[model samples]
Target: MERTSPPLRTVARAFEVIELLWELNGATLAEVTRRMDLPKSTVHDYLRTLEMVGYITRIGETYQLSYRFLTTGGRLRNRSRFFQTARPVVRRLADETGEVASIGVEEDGECVILHAMRGEKSLELGIYPGLRVPLHAHATGKVLLAHLPEAYAEETIFSDGLAAVTDHTITDVNRMKRELSAIREQGYAADWDEQILGMGTVSVPIVIEDDLVGSISVSGPTGRVEDDDYRAELLKGVREAANTIMVGYQYGH
Candidate 1:
């Protein structure tokens, strides 16, 4: 029989190698081999193939991601209706509340900030656009997680292993499950210094025609945000903003 091609494992390794290039910024043969603990020959072959397909580039014996792969994602972001509709609302919320406001989309078991507006306050922990936050930590992540199917929620919690980032972080799966259940009942989720010291956040899901489109959030110092009254007010504002986006999304259809 003729020699068969490599298995699916080969294809997966090839993609993993491509991902490694993104994290490396640019990696030499030695760097790639050492980082991935793979043979130099295998890495070199993957790099060559990626370069040929315009997915990666070789520069002075280093490999980095090429513009081709980024182009597709860039185009998608540019055309996204979610970003367009949510940006103004996020800006308005930030300006009104004088606190950081953000919009996050569920991606790869995490909440990825698509857009954000920094408040007037100095020294704020701003979540810039394109920042990836784990679903186990932040308010936006919690709200999105609360809206997911039970199976997905369990899978995410179990897969992520719920590492604790702060003393206040809920690392126990059962506790987080209960919290998410409460969030669903309350129509919002709140994080109290879970990810970072002195920071608190409130988030609400942006539902469109009963679909979990995304989440919108407000965040600031825990001192200013942790009170029950303040939390309720912030949650109300987030809900209003999310509703505005949902209305536009539904009406535009």
Candidate 2:
């Protein structure tokens, strides 16, 4: 079932004001008006509501975001149980494939790294827990995008816009759409130096309860990853690891 957004009201606008303050690291009322492109009166109303709710604080001449939002997002993340289930699975995939293995979840149309395991042999692909990467420039993003609802997929891609991070990155909207379609059919996405130089990666979506909830990935230097057999074996191991996590997710274990 599609989730319904909260009702649009003063409360919702107050939250948006807090987010903008957080993004700006605090701003004057004039700056907020310019960034939000709203009338001064409207911005002041939202700021007053947010201050009343303890979500933002006004100190002297500037408004600042409070830590309450951090607590809320942190609580939601801790309740997900995603890292606990993915840790061992990622380790196993790294051991089997002899490549860096990772598990990530989608948040706000971006990939948030939750767990990663490095192979015994050093690989140059840089990934670690808590590292966040944009969805437009990564194989992991492609897998997650391919599995999302069509409307969400289209909106994110269009909104984020395809700016080339590297020479090999897909920069055209139509090309990206076609690429995602292929990933959906093949059950995986691959990139050769698309985001970083001399690195390659494969990403596969993790499905549970018929929802595309996360992604599993294997990455290594181009020489090892470009080998056809090595790539195939890595994809196989990634799929197996994702399946393991899916089973764990299904049973609440």
Candidate 3:
């Protein structure tokens, strides 16, 4: 059996400090020390090291993340052929549907929005690139989950235990499994005020040569999304966008 190496404590602590700073949106040396329960000198050293590497910035006494992260994230996104190919298609879908259109992929058992574009009537739901959410709480997430390997999907679902984000969110494991099965058969997923109240979403998977690339979704107010005529239109738009992205990615366009 292959044994995995344990995580390095020094590196782990450094990441913890970074996450703490992110959660606080910036923190004084004293504040970091208090929150991390680490020695003041230790926290200061971590902060200084991160600052020296340009990952953190010191303004007055507050230490915050630097734009270096943004640069790194942008470079990573640019490297993804799938994301690059999906960008224009997703933007067009947003324009056609007049809602929030996004592409999402599963990472570390969670759904991460790769890119989100707002249309003329899109709601300001704080959806953005790099936003991560539970896989059972939204249309994009459900589509990705439904397409993933059975063992991996089962592990993710059981481990996460289906925490409810809103009253409409599915909290039962069996029910969620049934939903995934239906999604597989129907080739799409829909969420009505599940992740966020008043918001509705419809998503379709982007499959290339039987491989699940990711998912594309359109979101809007429940008032419009729940309407039979409008919902059908949105579903048609999202499905077409997903197909465009899949074909573009497969052809290396």
- lDDT leader: 3
lDDT of 2 by residue, 116-180 (tens): 88988847577876677777678888898888888887776565578888998889988888988
Report how far residue 51 has shifted in candidate 2, in Å. Answer: 20
Better of 1 and 2 by TM-score: 1
The candidate that wins on TM-score is 3
Instruction: List where candidate 1 sits over 4 angstroms from the true fold.
Output: 1-7, 67-69, 122-126, 158-161, 227-233
Q: Which residue pairs in model 3 clash with each other? A: none
Which has the higher TM-score value, candidate number 1 or candidate number 3? 3
CA deviation > 4 Å runs, candidate 2: 1-78
On a 0 to 100 scale, what is the lDDT of residue 145 in model 3? Answer: 94
- The digit string of per-residue lDDT tens for model 1 on 145-247 reads 8888777766655655798878888889888888888998999888878887888999999877667889999998998788989888888888899889988
- Please rank every candidate by lDDT, starting with the best: 3, 1, 2
Candidate 3 residue runs with Cα over 4 Å from true position:
1-6
Which is superior by lDDT, 1 or 3? Answer: 3
**All candidates' lDDT scores?**
0.84, 0.82, 0.91
Clashing pairs in 2: none
Each model's TM-score? 0.82, 0.70, 0.96
Clashing pairs in model 1? none
lDDT of 2 at 225: 81
lDDT of 3 by residue, 141-160 (tens): 99999989898877766555
Return model 3's CA RMSD, one decimal: 1.8
